[model samples]
Target: MNVGEWAAVIGAAGSLLGGGGFFVARATVKAARATAAAQQAAALATAAPAQQAANLAVLEATVRRVDEENGALRGEQARFRSLLRAFAWTVDRWAGQMHRAGIEPEPVHPLVEEYNRTGV
Candidate 1:
């Protein structure tokens, strides 16, 4: 072939090679990205159950702590109610003594009356 024709053939071959290399490189990069994404998804999938289990454990611990706190509060409430009842009894006994002595007793508190009525 003539030198000019040979040069033209070489130019065409170079252009095809360059374009094909670019396409191959682009395809390789795209495939690598997809593989990385799949790996990340698999890792997250494997970890999800462990994460959920940890969350459940934390929730159970919190519930147990709250229940214990509620139990302590109930004990305190019982003690307070007993003390209030004792106070009410003492007041009633004093009022009876005052009445027997011909002295007028103070009026009963509304709260004490409500507590007696509701047992709350």
Candidate 2:
């Protein structure tokens, strides 16, 4: 072949090689980005369960504390109800005593009469 023809052939071969190399480089970059994204997703997937566990633990602790407070409030309410009942009984006894001695007693409060009726 002539030198000029040989040079043309070499130029064509170099262009084809350069173009193929550029495509290969671009594909490699795309694959690398995909791998990086997959790794980030995997890391987040692993951390999600741990974060959920932490949140659940906090919720359980809050529930336990609320239960304890509820128990204390229940006890206080029972004590207050007992005192109220005792007061109502004393008022009834005083009114009975005054009636027996022929003295006119003042009327009992409506709330006290309702409590006596309901026995609640």
Report the number of the highest-TM-score candidate: 1
* lDDT at 22, model 2: 52
Q: Which lDDT tens digits does candidate 1 get at residues 35-114? A: 77999999999999999999999999999999999999999999998998898888878888999999997777898778
lDDT of 2 by residue, 65-96 (tens): 99999999999999999998898889889988
What are the Cα lDDT values of the candidates? 0.80, 0.81
| TM-score of every candidate relative to the true structure | 0.74, 0.67
Considering only N, C-alpha and C atoms within 3 Å, which residue pairs clash in candidate 2? none
lDDT of 2 at 99: 94
* RMSD in Å for all candidates: 9.9, 10.5
lDDT for residue 29 in candidate 1, whole number 0-100 = 62
Which pairs of residues collide in candidate 1?
none
Error of 2 at 108 (Å): 2.3
